[model samples]
Target: MYKILAVDDEIEILKVIDEFLTQAGFMVKIAQDAEAGLEILAKEKPDLLILDMRMPGIGGEGLLRELSRKKIDIPAIILTGYARTDAGLGFVKKDSLKILVKPVNLSILLETVNECLRGKRDGQTKDPDC
Candidate 1:
């Protein structure tokens, strides 16, 4: 089973994601903040990361930057209230990174997860099915 790490400040969101992904047969881990997420990253080394872009401290963007600085490469999906055209996401350089806005549908989330992981399996930036 693929290991997935989801980091969000909202406890409810984390719970929902954990339950959903777990039910989908993934080994899911949750972190309530970027700091905790970092610790989990070091220990768990998950295959994928589901990240909330906005948080109290060192939010999603910061975590991504830190990962880059550390030369850690992993597939990621970004959740944010911002739109696709949002200026806040300009710093993100990975072409394969998927950005899903808040109020994302569960089915779409599942589809994205499959596609992203499939790409990882195939050693590509994204699945051709995307």
Candidate 2:
């Protein structure tokens, strides 16, 4: 099973993601904030990261920037209700995948997650729909 690390400040959101991914046959890990997410990233090396764009400290963008600095190429799906604002742009890079708004559609999220994992397995560098 593909491992996933999902980070969000809201425990409810993390819980929702955990339940959904687990039902989809993934090994799911949850982090309540970015720092915890990073720690988990270093240790777990999940195949994918589902991150909330806004958090109390070192938000999703910060984590992704750190990942880039570390040369880690983990696939990611960023959730933001911000509508592509400048704050949300901090994490955009060549490998940008899906950026879902808050209250994400479960089916779309699932499709994107599956696509990301499949691309990883197929040796694709970027998600075509991005």
Candidate 3:
């Protein structure tokens, strides 16, 4: 089972994500904000991270930048309520699999998670010649 870290300031959002991802066969961890999320990341090192762009302190973009600086390569799917213009899409790198604008469709979130897990698995399996 894939391990996932889901971070959002809203308690309901964290609960929903935990329930949905757990039902989908992932081991899910929840964090209320970016600081908590980073603490969890330090210990768990989840296979994927689901982040909310807007939070009380150390927002998603800042967390992502910190992760990058620390050389953490975990794949991420960011959730944002703000408009793309205000949020500045530049924070999301091309390597990130998805950026879901709130309110997110559950189906799309599930699909993105599956796709990211698949990509991780595929990357781990390599041809001997390559």
Model 1 TM: 0.88
Q: How well does candidate 2 match the true structure in TM-score terms?
A: 0.88
1-130 per-residue lDDT for model 3 (tens digits): 7899999999998899999889988999999989999999999989889999888998888888888788777778888886572345464455654678888888899988887777656776212211
Order of quality (lDDT): 1, 2, 3
Report how far residue 20 has shifted in candidate 1, in Å. 0.5
Relative to the true structure, candidate 1 has a C-alpha RMSD (angstroms) of: 2.2
TM-scores, all candidates, are: 0.88, 0.88, 0.87
- Model 2 scores a C-alpha lDDT of 0.83
Q: Point out where model 1 deviates above 4 Å.
A: 85-91, 123-130
| TM-score ranking, high to low | 1, 2, 3
